[model samples]
Target: MVKFGVLVLLSAIAIGQGETTIESQCQVCQEENNVYCESESTFLRMRGAMKLGPLSCEADEVCSNSGNLCKKKTEITNEVLNVCGANCQSCSADRKYTCVSRNQAALCLNGQASSTIIIDCGEDEVCVDDDDGKAFLCVPSCVADYQKLSVPCSSAAFTTPTPAPPTTPSGDNQKSICQAAAVNKKTLYFFTYADSSCRTYVYCERSSSTSTDFTTTLSGSCSSPNPYFNTVSGKCQASVPDNCESEAPST
Candidate 1:
């Protein structure tokens, strides 16, 4: 939150028979306040006893911790950091967005909910509470039941193995998948593994509306913490739904 203040100074002098008073005006910024980003390019923080700035970040940079600190867009994690331009919302104790609808979730920032930002689940996906019920995550269409997706697809649930390729030699088979999407009038499609591993996904895009053929743009696994492709926001997210396989615990 942004805070504003007015500063006043006064002095009095006494003469033999009269007295005079002097006053001055200034602005106040507390030194102890935590730094926060006010926008993508600007931030406000304390410098000494005065408010520093809603200062501008350099080109290719965005605000982060202290107002003086800025970083490249690729250096920061979108889901974890309280960076500017995240469109944070107003939220209290429960920071997670409850499903506004079966397919939609609210976007939050710094424990506050954004007044306007909401995420819609992708095709064949639905908004559901995560395993701990501490947050909401978009899960597959087959998982509408209240029963948690606790069971792993295989018995070796605790091991972290390299993600296996799709069951059908799917990487060599982009034409069929892309054609299917094109037939449905969709120029773009994102597909996860058949095993619900949540580690890898594929992205395909048609060249044009007239084109029956498509190209694969990305086929890879997500990074740590956000090892799952969230169908709701169409981005990598931190949570691993119960239906998805879990990584081996760090020794």
Candidate 2:
């Protein structure tokens, strides 16, 4: 199989053709970060091509647009800005790239622990560290010596609340879940969708300071590697559950 990196190099070559070519004067960053694309050409080329570098900046380093590559935080002459925006609070660089598994990874946005986004490698890709082992990257599974790559953290390093199903639930149904919890006097509750499809689940919680009041706090479709939502465990699992009413949702 063609490697993802090789495919990127091919796309870069193709972009140079016709009007899509990037010129020397283009005001673009010399390097790309794991989160955002720095150059318009690079961004355009990678929009749907494949996953690109999820490179991270060191604790003392900041992603600089200049050609010298990453620069020390102290060297910045202006206010420091997080590319991921305000919601992501600053955290240590050690939490930057978390490996959920060889095929899955999560990026600590703006170095923030609470704000993380999962990075699912392509079907043929696997998560691995860069040559320097300073950043987490996704490469073709066929690449050799992948086990030698560094893994910044284990699955326990960061965990996101199970995502709700892609389909929005009816208001009455959402209210019902919370109402059941409230009636049971349960502070928190997790339950599978009525259809018992492995794709989605609901997480409900009682409103603070209101014992009788409850609300649906979060819900979303289970992601890759753990696509099936096991009703008994109230979490996504790798295997099919006996109660599953449907196969995993199409990607």
Candidate 3:
């Protein structure tokens, strides 16, 4: 199962020396033994590190052997080179997120679990863990940012040490998941907003390609999006329950 964090969004830092952790704060780390040292190559990792968006690194910033990736420097025993896909960042300083060649929900269960690799997705996409915690996959996000999502749906986005939706299409302009179809193929996307209302939206395509517009499947305000879509009930639920055992996996 995925070890989801409880903190909101990417602010998953462990309190130390009476202050929260900040990756760019290298000077503070030098003064406090308890604090992790920020990576020396901050300039090199700027773009990638920002993607950490609201997520925190496993340790303070210790540079990866390649100097391109960063992770906590304390994980000496678990350090190993891992290959990440183009969708996600090449590596993370923390182990919470990982990259897999295949879009399997499975986390880094094998030898690579310790590496700081993040699953790949589009610039607007995010890595979403399943309700069962057995699988993690990349998908477009609903909340403008991770820090705002609510329960269950927040599990994947809020992967801090202690931190922590869907719908279909229709003929009505509002009922459709998107205004157009996917450029690659017909793919259905799910999202939950971080707004206090916690509205739910979906972007389903009739083909395998990408699309510019997405449709709102459900607009449950003040409610989080269910981790999995219930094909049986055709509604959003905490869990999909079936996991599509009787049917083939949907694209």
Candidate 4:
């Protein structure tokens, strides 16, 4: 009987050791602090405070157990801008705009009309246009166009195929004559109906000229090479030259 009891005790001890080995082999958590278990029955049910090791598990296993166990990392590029997504960041003029990424910066051209320059930024990067005056933040949609208008005397001529005015005068009466001619004959139309000449003539005829000042004259042709209109100034202003921005890429 003594020998039999001794054998039974040894058997029980061996069983306990086996259970401990199985528990150690099972992973209790994942790398991202997620809990995992191979078997529901093996999990401990006790509440209260339990000191657990760092949650560590294989990637595939962790993903299989919990949908939120892991996340894909984003790749950073060299062309990204430094001040991407921030407010009022300056842009590079050479390429028309600058972009910043987590690891690098890049310059891109603005392809759209009135588009502002921009930089590349990582998922959390911010950029802004210092030139905007309002300090607007840069976004993926941001683009820049820094070309200036070249307004030469010849460029002022109407581009439309329509016949030119009877003559291009050479004196002070040139502007006035053009206005009077445009009004009376209605034959002097701007290449683009919205030509600066149209505005100048209309303004001179309505506001500057009077019954007695009919002979008065203004200098320069009214046509402008630039198409932009400054509503605030109520006039047409020249745009910044591409070279000007090149010297100062930012702001």
lDDT of 2 by residue, 157-176 (tens): 22333222345445466566
Instruction: Estimate, for each residue in 11-78, the C-alpha lDDT of model 4 and write its tens digit.
Output: 11111212211011122333222332222111111113442111112211111222233221121122
Output the better candidate (3/4) by lDDT: 3
lDDT, each prediction: 0.39, 0.39, 0.29, 0.23
Best by lDDT: 1
Error of 2 at 110 (Å): 22
Q: What is the TM-score of each candidate against the true structure?
A: 0.25, 0.30, 0.19, 0.18
Instruction: Give RMSD (Å) of candidate 3 vs. truth.
Output: 19.7
Q: What would the per-residue lDDT of candidate 3 be over residues 1-251, giving only the tens digit for each residue?
A: 33333212333222233332121222111222222222222211132222111112222333333332444444322222111211122223323434232221224534234323334345554453323333344544553233322111211221211111123222363233244223333445433222222222222323323545443222221123454433333344564345344331223
**Off by more than 4 A, model 1:** 1-171, 180-185, 188-195, 240-251
Ranking by TM-score: 2, 1, 3, 4
Cand. 4 TM to true fold: 0.18
Pairs clashing in candidate 2? 34-54, 163-219, 163-220, 164-219, 164-220, 164-221, 165-220
Question: Candidate 1 lDDT, tens digit per residue, 173-241?
Answer: 445544543444544443433234555444444567567666532243455657666433345568875
Model 1, residue pairs in steric clash:
88-114, 89-112, 89-113, 89-114, 90-112, 90-113, 91-112, 91-113
lDDT score at residue 196, model 1, on the 0-100 scale: 48
How many pairs of residues collide in each model? Answer: 8, 7, 40, 26
Segments in model 3 whose C-alpha atoms lie over 4 Å from true places: 1-61, 64-109, 113-124, 128-133, 137-139, 144-251
Off by over 4 Å in 2: 1-165, 170-172, 180-187, 207-212, 231-234, 242-251
